[model samples]
Target: MPAGTGGSENYTVGQVRELNRQGVPAQVVTVGLDADDGRSEFNDIPFRSLATLSEVGGLDGTIVFVNEPHTVPTKQLSYLILHNPPPIRDEQKAFAVRGTRNRALIVTSRYAAALWARYLDVDVSTINVVYPFAEPCFAEQPRPDTSAGTTRVLFAGRLSPEKGVYTLLETLHIDIIEQDVALTFTATTAGADKPQGKIIERLLGAHPGISVVTSRKTPATMAALMADHDVVVMPSNSQYWHETFGIVSVEAQHSGCRVIASDDGGLPETDCGGVVLVEPDNAEALAWGIRAAVASGPLSRAARQDAAARFTVKQSVNALLNVFAQPAPIPPATIIRQLEEQVLAPSAKVATTSRPDNVLIETAV
Candidate 1:
C-alpha cells in the first residue's frame, strides 16, 4: 500500500482489510506509487501500481478509486471517494469532476456531501456517505489513567496550519493555561519531512514545555500512543481547510480518550460520545477546551462503549456493499451505443484504452 501518513491512508488500508474479512474483495491500485516506495506500513494489504490513473479506465468489475478523480472514465463499474474538499476555484475542480463521469461519488460525511454538491451544482443525494471506521487496534488499546490531576494531551494530526498546529502553538503558553489547563502537551512529527511540516516542527522546537516525537507509522502504533494519553486535540482550521471527516477524532474516542475538535465541518459528527467541540482557529477557545477536558477527568466506561456500535469496519463495509448492489444508472452515451450495435453489422473497430506503462492488476478478498 502507498505510504501516506494521514487519515486518508488509514481509511483506505482499514477499508481494504475489513472488506477482505467480510469476504468482499478489494485491492489498492496506486498511481505514481510503488510497492516499496517509502515505508512498509500497511504491508498486509495487497497493492498494484500504475504509472497514471488513466490506465485503470478499462479495468473491468467494480473499481473503487480514492482521493484524485481519474481523468478517464472507467469502462465498467466504478466509485470515487472524495476524501478532501473541492478546490476553491470552480475551473480547477470542474474539469476533474466532468472527466470522470457516471461513477457513484462517495463522501465521508453529510457535511462533505453538501460541500461538494454546492461546489459542483449537483443534488446532495448524488454524493453518498461512507464513514471511515476506527480500525480494531484503536479500541483494543488500554485506556490511560487520568486521575493523577494531570491530563496528558496529544496532538496526533499532521503538524500543519490546516490541521491547527499553529493555533495550538499559540494556545498552550502559561498565560493561557494558568494552572487551569493542567496537562502535559505533546505533538507528533506526522508530516515533518515535508516543507510545511519542517517549518511547523521548527516552530514547535522553539516553543516551551511541548514534547515532540516522530509520527506513528501504523494503526497499532498510533493506538498505543493514544492509549498513553488522556485526550486528543483536533483544532482543524476552518479558513483554509474544512475537515471532511476527522477520522482521527473517532479513533481517539475509540482509544478511550476525549476528542477536542473544531465545531465546524464534519468534525461534530465524528463524536462517539466523548468529543468536545470548540470554535475553530481560536487559540483561547482551544486552550479552554483543553482545560475543560482536563477538568472532566477520565472518560467513563459507559461513554467509551458507543464506538463499536456506531462506527466499525463491519458496518462501513456492509454499507458500501449495499451501495454497490444498487443498479448503476446508464448514461445517454451508453444507451446510444447499445442502439447502434443492434442495427449495425459485425463490429470491426476496437476501442483502445492503454498507456505507455502497463497497470498491474491483482485480485483480493
Candidate 2:
C-alpha cells in the first residue's frame, strides 16, 4: 500500500492488521526501489517485497490498493487511490494514465474524487469516495482547564513545506499573539530526501525555545502526546501537496483536541464538527484560528462522539470491502489512445509489468 513507513503506509498497516484480526487474509507487499530483499513483520502481518510475492504468484486474484501507480503492477483488481495534487504537467499525464489502467479508482474525500475525475477525464460516478480512518488507539484524553492559562499547541506529521510548517513558524514569530501558549513540533524526516525537512531544521535552529518532542513514536505514544495538547494546527499549503485527508487533524479531534487546519484539499471535507478551518499559507489566519481554539475550550462531548461514530477503522475497512466486491469497468478507447500517445511517448520512460523496480508505491503524503 505504502512505499515506506510514512502516514499512509502506517495507516495501511493498521487497517490490514485489523482486517487480519477479523479473519481477512490480508498481507503487506511493500513496493520500493530497495534491493536485497529482507523479510520483516509490521502490525503482526508478514511484510514482503513485490519481487518476492511475484515469484510465488501471491499477486494472483489479490486486490492491490495503490496511491502510487507508477511503481505498482496493474494486475488483477488494482484500485488506484488518488492523493497527491501533482503540479508537474508530465507527472500529471503519467498519473492520469496509470490511474485509468487500474480496475477501480478510490478517493478519501469527495473533493479528491471530483478533482481527480476532472483531471483523469472520467465521469464523477466512476470514482468511489471512501474516507480514511484513525486507529482505535487515539482515544480521548482528559483536557486541561484552559482558565489556568498556558495553552498547548501541537504540529505533528512530516516537517515539510506542504504541511505548512513554514506558515506555523511565521505565525509563532508574530508579536501580536498571546505569549501564554506554548508550541511543540514532533516527527523527524531524517530519511526523507525533501527540501521541507531542511527548511524545518533551519526554522527550529532559529527558534530554540519551541519544544521538540521525540519523533518516530508508536501509535499509542503519538495518541497520548496528542491527547495532552489543547489545539493541533495543520496549515498545509496548496502550492505543492495540499492537505489531502489531514490524518493528524482527525487523530487530534478523536483524541479530544480541537483542530485548527487549513481549508485546502480534503481538509474541508473532514467536517465532523469542532474543526476551525482557516486559509492556507496565511500566518494571520492560522494565528487567529489558534487563538480562537484557545478561547473556545476543549472539544464538546458531541464532537468527540461524532468522531468516534464516523471515523472508525471498522467503517473504512467495510467500505473498502464493498469496493473490492464490485467488478472493474473497462477503460474507454479514447483513454487507451491517450495513454499510448502521452504516457508511453518516446520522451516518457516506458513502463513494464515484469520489472518490480519500475513499480511505484504512492505514499499519499
Candidate 3:
C-alpha cells in the first residue's frame, strides 16, 4: 500500500490491473481517505482499513506488498518492499528495523537497492531489483508535426517545490523569453498548497506566453494533453520529492513527444532510448537540453514505437509475479537455533493449536 497519488499509486493500480488481466490474483490497498469515485474498481479488492491493518488478523504466510515501507505498519508482517524515493535518514532507520524482520525487500531500480543496502546496513541478499513498467496508455501513438514554429511543452503534475517548478520557470525565462522562441508551457496543478499556487501564479504572470492549465485531468484528458504537446520537459531536482520512474515521461513518449527529463532517482530507468536526461537543478543545462530536444526535431515514429513496446503494464506485472513466486529465504541457521531454543519450546503448544497441524517444527533439544 502507498500513502497517496503519484508514481506509486499509478504503478500499483496499473500493475494490479495487469496482474488481474493475466489471471493472477492481485489487489491494491491505499490509505487515501479522500473519496475518488473512479478508484472504486480497485477499491473493491479486499481493502483492509489502513488504520486497522495491524490489528486485522489472518495474514500469516501471505506476502504483504508495500510500495513505501515507511508509510505502512511493517512490524506486522514480512513485506515485499518497493523502494522508490531517496529515503531520509530516519526513514532508513525505520526501514532497517523493519526490513531485517520482513521476508524480503524489492526495489524498482538497482540504484535504489544499492543505496538502501549501503545506508541501512542490510545484506544485499535481502534486496531485489525489479524495474517498473509503463501502462499501455504509454504505447506509441501518432506523432504530431514539429516544424519549429510554435512548440507546445507539457508538464503534467503537481506544482510543488520538489518538482523544480521555480527552476522550470527560470528555464522558461531563458529559453522562451530571452531566446525569443514561441513556446507554450502547459501545466496542471494536482496537490499543492496555497503558497505554492501563488508562486506558480506569479511565475505565470511574469510570462504571458506560458499558459497554466489548472484542472484535474482524467487519464483520457492527460493523454490528450500529451498528444497536444510537441515536447515534454521534466526539470525535477534531486530533492526528496523528485520523480521515481517518471510515468509522465513514458506517457509523453507514447504520445510521440520528445522527452527531456532530469537525471535523478528512477528517471534514468525511464530514459528508454527516447528520453534525453539533463542535469538536475541546472537551469542553464535544462534550457540547453530543451533547445537540443527542439533542434533534434520530432522523434521518429519508429523510436516512439520502440519505447512504447519496451515499457508495458504486462511486463511490469510479470516481473512482480516472478518476484512473488520466488521462494522466500529459509530462516537462517543461527536464527533457527535461536528460535528453537527461546521460542519453539515454550510457544510450540500454543502455536500448534493456533496454527495448522501440518506446520513444520524444528526442535531445539
On TM-score, the leading prediction is 1
Best by lDDT: 1
lDDT of 2 by residue, 226-342 (tens): 777778888888776766587777888888888899988889877567799998889999989988987898778787878767667888888878877777655443466776887
Worst 10 residues of 1 by lDDT: 356-365
Go through the candidates in order and give the clash count of each: 0, 5, 0
Which residue pairs in candidate 3 have backbone atoms (N, alpha carbon, C) closer than 3 angstroms, thus clashing? none
RMSD of each: 12.6, 12.7, 9.3
User: Model 3, which residues run further than 4 Å from truth?
Assistant: 1-4, 31-51, 56-61, 70-77, 89-92, 140-148, 175-177, 193-207, 215-217, 239-243, 330-365
- State the number of backbone clashes in model 2: 5
Q: Candidate 3: how large is its RMSD?
A: 9.3
Pairs that collide in candidate 2 are: 68-362, 70-360, 71-359, 71-360, 72-360
TM-scores, all models, native as reference: 0.86, 0.80, 0.77
List residue ranges in candidate 1 displaced over 4 A. 1-4, 37-39, 144-147, 178-181, 330-365
Question: What lDDT does candidate 1 reach at residue 209?
Answer: 68
**Candidate 2 global Cα RMSD:** 12.7
**Model 3 lDDT per residue over 222-299, tens place:** 666677787888888785654656777877787778888898877788766668889999888888877787778777
Q: Model 3 scores what on Cα lDDT?
A: 0.64
